[model samples]
Target: MEVAMRKKIRRIITILGTTAMIFTVTACGNRMDTMQPAASYVADFFDIPDTVTGIERLLLKDDMAYLCCLEEDGTSYLAAMDIDDGKFLKQNLDLDASVSLLDFGFAPDNSNWAVCLEKAGGYSLRKFDNSGSQVQSVDLAGVMDSPVISAVGRDLFLSIDMEGNICVAAKGGNTLVYLFDNNGRFLFSLDYEGNLMTTTTTAEGKIGICATSSDRMNYDLLTVDMETQDWSKDKICLGATAGLYGGVNKDFYRFDSSVLYGYAAGAQEGIPVFNWSDMGLGTSEVQLGECTDGRFVVLTASSNQTEVLSYEMAVLTEGVDERELLSMVSLTATPGLVQAVSDFNKTNDRYKVELTEYFPYAQNVSNEEWDNAILNLNTRIISGDMPDILDMSNLSVQIYQSKGLLEDLYPYMENDPEIRTEDYFENVFEAISLDGKLPYLTDGVAISTMLAGADVVDGNNGWTIQDLEKVLDTYGANSINNLSGASFLKIMLQTDGSFIDWNLGKCSFDSPEFVKMLEFAGKIQESSQDGCGGTEMSDTYAEAYEEVLSV
Candidate 1:
């Protein structure tokens, strides 16, 4: 029996906005060249690496950073990197010869061709196996590199080019986005959109965010699909637009729950905290009255007894109930090359609770019980009444993705191909099997790993403010989402956007317009600029053009 080549590469497409480019693939005898790893490649610029011999191009991918090398048999292989420890792992593929590529990308699972590259040479596409071997082939003539490749899913690629852009040659291809290349050339684009997005640029492939603008613009955010060249318009507000003085988009002044929050590193006494994300103009429990990066002052009614807490949109990764990752490092011991890992991670706390479990109720349950139990189960799951892990032997827990319950475990799988490729037994790893003969039961439960809280957390009983001081006072340690020090993330916690319906992916941020109502109370803080906001900001008259007249 012949051994199958590993890491097979099928097609490679080059994508980018180029000054000029060309794709020229010629059919000649394979140019047998030894492949070695190049020290480095352009992260964004066209810079080359130094001091390397065994690979053609170095590929830095989303799941794993890898170096491309050639096997003795002429197939390509990728040397993987361990992000936690920063070590190189060499993965090889089986092939006879005749595979050369300029650009490529490793998918989340370290598998090849989660994307296609737009190259300057003939159809610059490369496909590889898990072991880093070429498994497939696609040849096209006169290709250019002005292309964008986005693979938010498996086996699908969205590639956009400046030109000779990716044209849908076959049927079932017309349904994609298209665009004109830079310098006024028409090109085809494709649809491959996802709720979440990220980009990359490399010889294995590259992606960039490009836009055109005028001196005076009305709407500024333009989203161009690299694969389709299709575009969408957005106002592009980085959350709250609190003018220049401490807004969400700005650095220090972060808004949370429409309240302006700040840290006082300089003040000799105490500090005041407010929902910085909401930067209202007044002094209220839910409003940000007076705050500063270095000075915070809290003002409250003498009648109030309860202290208001900085509310979080969701339970944080470091909440009281969340598990913490233990550190294994030692101070006195001579540090070994190998690093020890701890399981007690306390940071997996960012959860809307209900939204994650509700969507899968139908998929994991059978049709006989799908409808009847789905709603109840979803409600139970979101309500936090369910166990951390669910028994799915008789239950069918399909990996429903439309809702944000699942984390596209693809990235984790890409980092560990062998772990995700095999059948998941009971949601647990096959190698880490629990019982016998139960592939379904062998899988790891989502609840077991995630610190999923009770669903009631997202309900209308959101947050109640009794005393205004807990949230606004400079002394309060637990800000929204359990922030201790000055944190930008606290702002993400302070909005109606923070509370979400896990089942439907519904969030409260831009909702029932009550969020604006909450904002109504908040504008009191930012707009004040008075003594109430803080002593520093207390009505200070700027020196007029004619200062002598003031005397």
Candidate 2:
């Protein structure tokens, strides 16, 4: 039944016109001036199908690009596109309810490919020829019998080497790399210490796995020869922390920010092959696959002004020009800021905002990865290599201000004729001011409010601590709705900002007024524990409101 449904889904073939944009990045002598446009490479952009919801993996086989795409109906299929003509073909594979597609890769010969699937009992490996026909299916439960497989969870990596040998790797508690022959026969498994960073297969049929030391300060690349069945480990120094982009012959690509670096199998250093910054492209969520012809296939998904995500496919070849880059760094990409930067670049020719996100959107971000990224950002700031603009949404602005790393924005606002002090809310500026100086500006503000019956406070819209105390005394604490200690404290903190004095760098938490508020909250908590507080209005308030209505 599953195979029949897969065959049914493969009956449809739709041809749509693809959108393409040719962009160039040029290099100038030994120094690449980011502000000036120089000659480098050309980029061709294409539109992905609207029905394709997500791309699990992208592979380039000769002139064709294959993508394992998930559709809106929650089914997975393979879509092939002719790179030159922009023609697309969709074919669904035999995936049932009991199994899920984990990862897929193509053989070096471009004549066949394979997918790794996770099932209830264990895992399965399915192989298919270039024509999309199944050639072999092997159950990997017995083959992957090591206890490390169960300990590593399910973060799996699959690839096919030059000699059509299959390699699968799992990373978590430890790193395990398994090698298998093309005939679905198990060969050998290599174990390595530390966390696995990435894995790649070179043209010489050698599988390379990069892992970080326990301290995370050192990196090592383990290379395994499929035929010889011998492996070697060597320390390597990379230009920047990067993820592997697979291998094209002897050279493999590593992606960091908007730059793509190419390195030989055993080389310590990699040279930049493509820089999306040179073409004024935002690197928010990008996936790259290298072609055999020295070109690249890039898949990028970005949110528009309406907050709708759109995907684009681009081909990067040798020839384009650079643009003036205004660099910006942030922990994650915010939709509004990304849209604003894209709009500014479209309208202005002199400058473009290059936003670099340390932690892009992911299902799960390990605590170690988050901490390392934060440390990296702090190191850059301390070394005076920070970007032109820093998104302080996820950062501590007060700490930066204390260190005198932030600049005062009040002077600039005062000199600008368009921005008048009277035009905006004065309190908004006062709220964030540090030491009587405005260091940052916000686009909008959120107001926290509490709603009450006008008759309860005699039509008064404002209330002080004395007024609150009088009301509580008159109606009893249970007359309020679910005003427990935790709720009361939350409301006070949200509605009041007087606790922290930004200008003086002090907090009034120890003051008598704050102490009194805490005591009042504690009384409410005790009442709640005694069964006097609830979600609904108490009988006292209900009876009083009924009497008023009768009058």
Candidate 3:
């Protein structure tokens, strides 16, 4: 098989040309003024145990921190720690590796807590006493249908009312919420349509759920009576920019860029609880829980490559020489960027970078939502409220550059003593440069190439549209490779230098060459049914290419 593959690759290299593409980390040259630094609202940082490799859920009640922790060996357990002394109180009730924990929370009476886990059969509701001892385990396989269980979504919520009644809500094709008595007996179920936004249990033991409306513009707050199995819903407008963070006992927290607001049941107005800027935290992946004494506990995770390296817990009091705030915006708050901002804030006393994620929950958003977010960002830029830095990975650089919104970094690079053009890859700078101006600076570059055999192209290193057509005609439609039209177009666009004339600030997409390429791509896509082009080269193929390149 290896020898056959090598022969096929060598034949193909005769027809295609090598293409190199670069991906970059872009940063603008905008800095805000520095302000006087004062103490932050963070009371203290608590040290967590080394045994706790990851924290899935963190809850605070009665000055105790309850965490559903995972170990290095993939086993998980419930842990409790004293907030004041940062001492471990209990670390018991271990779960098997096969059981996947969905959510965990405390009972309203504070007597015990429970973790909702999903296993092979279905869901398991395991109750634990305050001392972290296993009290009761309820298997919910018989209650919910297999189809519903299989299609269960990640927006699951487990809430315990004042009477110790358990409510398990899973959002899938339909939002199905189940209620169980203290003894684990199934009580009632509430089936609703639309996506689940947030869930909360009121002080009166009523379970409240906020779900999206059919129009997707408003929210429907559904409050269920656990005792009577009756429910009522009210439609509320949460604005275009407001996002439901989470819900506590009686209040559901919604946030924008800076402020987190709390809304009570059936109330359209929200009260400002706290501002993220005042907390001195950079990332928005914060977990906020209210304590019994009216204080709030904030949990933030220090992560690397999406893995939790450590967890930091701080207390948010009732309320900074305000550090000069450098606002940075991105669609998603990547783990590396979050870690860098946290480190910068820790070391710098004058200025702090505040990351504002327009779509923090990017995984669950729709295309319309993305468009709306981009529109909002464009509006902000037009209004002169633009952020100091913009992560342009998902944005169009050409439009920004054409509109004169981006500043050229060439002057800054020339003036800075630390920046030397000789130390970096000069070709990359030239490739991305627009009319001798560098609009942004990148930390790295990536290369992508496509190899063609010299024999197919008359031993020429490069070929034009006519040459590609002749080769295609000779080899038949499926000869080049079984790449889809879209995939082929993307590669061609990246490699074609004539398509975009950066010097003239124009594009030749409507040219005859581009049209011909599109026609060829369409023909190839239609001829290949499976679209299995072996687009990615294997390790053996790469090794062979290295040998071929050396010649």
Best by TM-score: 3
The CA lDDT at 215 in model 2 is 52
List clashing residue pairs in candidate 3.
13-452, 13-453, 14-453, 16-452, 19-450, 38-321
- lDDT per prediction? 0.26, 0.60, 0.60
- TM-scores of the candidates are 0.21, 0.60, 0.68
Q: How does candidate 1 fare on TM-score?
A: 0.21
Better of 1 and 3 by TM-score: 3
Model 1, residue 73: C-alpha shift (Å): 21
Instruction: Give candidate 3's whole-model lDDT.
Output: 0.60
Q: How many clashes in candidate 2?
A: 14
lDDT score of residue 200 within candidate 3: 58
lDDT of 3 by residue, 152-229 (tens): 643567777667787787777657888888777889898878677656565445666667766554466677776468
lDDT of 2 by residue, 1-551 (tens): 21111110101110110110111111111211233212256566677777776676677776888887766665667788777766778865655644556667776555454545565546777877666667778887887764656665436777777777888888866677888887768899887776786676654456677776555544556677665676664445543344666667435676655456677767887765644554434454556677777677777665442454566777767763356766677665444444455556545667766656665322124556667878888887777675766766545566777777777788878899888988877776776677898767664444322234566668765555566566668767655444456656755664354697655787779978789888877765664432223323444451111100100
Ranking by TM-score: 3, 2, 1
Model 2 CA deviation exceeding 4 Å by range: 1-42, 92-99, 118-122, 146-154, 196-198, 203-205, 216-220, 227-230, 235-242, 273-285, 304-310, 322-350, 354-440, 443-551
